[model samples]
Target: MSWTDGPFMGFDTETTGVNTATDRIVTAACVEWRNGQTRERTWLADPGIPIPKQAQDVHGISTEYAKENGRPLDEVVIEVAKVLETCAHAQVPVVIYNACFDLPLLNNHLVRLGQPTLGERVDFLPVIDPLVLDRALDRYRKGKRTLGALADFYQVRGEDNLHDALVDVRQTIAVLRAICTAYPQLGEMDLRQLQEYQRGQHRQWAEHFNQFLLSKGRSADVNEEWLV
Candidate 1:
């Protein structure tokens, strides 16, 4: 049996900006599911940088607010890393909506702060990306692809907002279930195999999206920073 036979965790984070190398984490959440039960943990950190108004507008985290109410960045990062490391050792897949962004952004924070980088060990563990799966399976689908949009498409309710970390994690789990239901063919595979399958699908989906952009005379920026 694969790791999917046991427990799993869903993770999400809201940051100060799009640059993984420079942006700071404002909020992060993780939801763990096992034996039909779910538990969630969230953290708000004082990023020690000015949260630009544009970024704050999206995630609703202000510099003043975080500095006054949030925990220290080092403390929050350590706690999150410890939990992630423990889960990784247990063979639990961390289901992130967008692994390319969150995973690297997290590692960057840890490395900059002289803390242990979760990516060093956690990279070997399984990671499931529902966003990639959604685009891969529905390559031709139109309109938005944000979490809220995907939630609406799958008829998964209770997730209209995007800022609150814990709420977003709960909604992410719901969206994952909806995706599994919508794409039954891919849902039957074990965790590791499923991850491998999605990577190929992601490549095809990226090409399709790029082609669509080209037809409109617009060039797609391939950099990950443009993802947000």
Candidate 2:
């Protein structure tokens, strides 16, 4: 069977800010799809820091509310890591919209909490990132490539509740399935080949984008790593 037909897990995070290295996770969700069934798990964390107004505006999780209603940050991070590790051990692909940002951020959180990092726990392989796949497959598609835009472009359901971790995870899975339908070649690839393809594609795109930035007299800041 195609890897696309096998068990896969979708992951997403809503954070306190855009600085993945420093920002804390305010919310996270994982949706596991297998054998035509789906199981979802979600977390809301205190983050142990103030959730900036701008970030709260995007996700509607205010600092005050999170402090009152959320679980401990360490507990949330540990549980999320365990879930991802479980999927990794089971050889399930984790479908993340942008693996680069979320995975590193979660790893940072694990370090901060004095826990084993994801790489140490399990081989961080066979990750399926719809964002990288779409950019590589479509190449020159104009306009925004945000999750909401992809949902609209792919005609996936559940576009209304974006920025919520669980909703975004669901939308990401739908977008990935839509992408596979549009590009059957992806379904033909084994998980390792697909992951390597994305690594190369993301590197090429980053180099091109960096060159564009340098041409426009801006700093070339795009990361070339697929899952850093």
Candidate 3:
């Protein structure tokens, strides 16, 4: 596939909490950039549970508001998965900041509702994580490791608001482009090759990060295995 023949779908989600099995998705946003153009979409779902004050503060969607205004969780999840699966079939990578979190959370949501989970085939098609790429590219950099900070470091803009999934997805594209500019070698690689490169980079990042923590006299949490 041509590297630029996108339908590169970038995805992000806002949820009740970070626990994939327990928490539910409250909102999600996706951007489908196809053949150099883009279409954006967002979904807000009732989550079927109270959105805690702390979680609501992050994404600005409360439980009562969701109950009144949001669509059913199943409907939202199905559409989101379908949109992503379509893009993947077109040889597009669903660019996410942390696919490990968002993809699994979405799958768990489906499983919880007695629906089919988004299988590995639905997930592994050329996925990209700007967070892991940034960590890999700048392994020795100090300070914050957030999406916004990476945007700043790469000189990629439009990350003033992060909790909004749609907005974050656009910024993620900018971050990817910036990384390509910073590391010209990446521009030569096709989608599948790039995905493999990212997998290696993520593995190295986990090793390096864990080593840093250990050097600082801290024990790594087992729960953080996903990040590794």
Candidate 4:
């Protein structure tokens, strides 16, 4: 059986804003499908800051709600990092939708809290990012590449809501399985090769996107790394 037939983990986060460096994590989730068994952990964090309405609209977690019921950010991040470390140490591939956003955001928070960053924690964790995979495999496919769109294209079941970390993480795995089913070539590659492929693919996309940004006179630097 392929690695896909064994175990994998899904991780996602909902934060105060898009600025991964400064924004706070409001909620997070880690889901594991191991030996065909599903285990999930979810956390809500007070974050100690006001959550922008725009961000709150996306995930439905309000600052007031979080303050009332959520755990402190430092404590929350500690536990979340442990879960991530344990899974990745086991070499279980982590399925993250837009790894660039979530992973950096998680890492930044960890660093600020004086905890070990992902790079300091693991050698190299195999990550399956469906968004990166889709763009790599089919660069010319025209429509939206959001998780919901990919789920619809692959006929994967999506959650009723899009931004909830748990729902999004679960759907990400479903879409990955669908991608592997449709593209056997992907599954044939081992984890190292797959991550290398994603790195090359990310480089390709970054170059392309950089040019597009330059054309429009926009200049936000895109990180070239695929995984942390």
- Sorted by TM-score, highest first, which candidate order results? 2, 4, 3, 1
- RMSD of each candidate? 2.9, 1.1, 2.5, 1.4
lDDT of 2 at 210: 98
For all predicted structures, in order, the TM-scores are 0.88, 0.97, 0.88, 0.95
Best by TM-score: 2
Number of backbone collisions per candidate, in order?
A: 0, 0, 0, 0
Shift in Å, residue 134, candidate 4: 0.6
User: What's the lDDT for all of these models?
Assistant: 0.79, 0.91, 0.80, 0.87
Candidate 2 lDDT, 1-228, residue by residue in tens: 899786889999999998988999999999998887899999999999999999989999999999999999999999999998988888899999988989999999999888999999986556999999999999999999998899999999683678899999989999999999899988888888887899999999999999999999999999988875
Residue 138's lDDT in candidate 1: 85
Highest lDDT: which candidate? 2
Q: Tell me the tens digit of each residue's lDDT in model 3 across 1-228.
A: 446445578899999998877888898999877766888999999999899999989999989999999999989998988887777777677889877789889888777767766565354566778777777778788988788888888888782688888888898888877886787776678877877777777777667767878889998542434422
lDDT per residue (tens digit) for residues 1-228 in model 4: 677675888999999999988999999998898775789999999999999899989999898999999999999988988887887788888889989888888889899988899779988877888999999988999999999999999998754788888998889888988888888888788898988999999989998888889899999488766764
The local lDDT score (0 to 100) that residue 186 gets in candidate 3 is: 65
Instruction: Locate the minimum summed-lDDT window of 10 residues in model 2.
Output: 154-163
Give candidate 3's TM-score.
Answer: 0.88
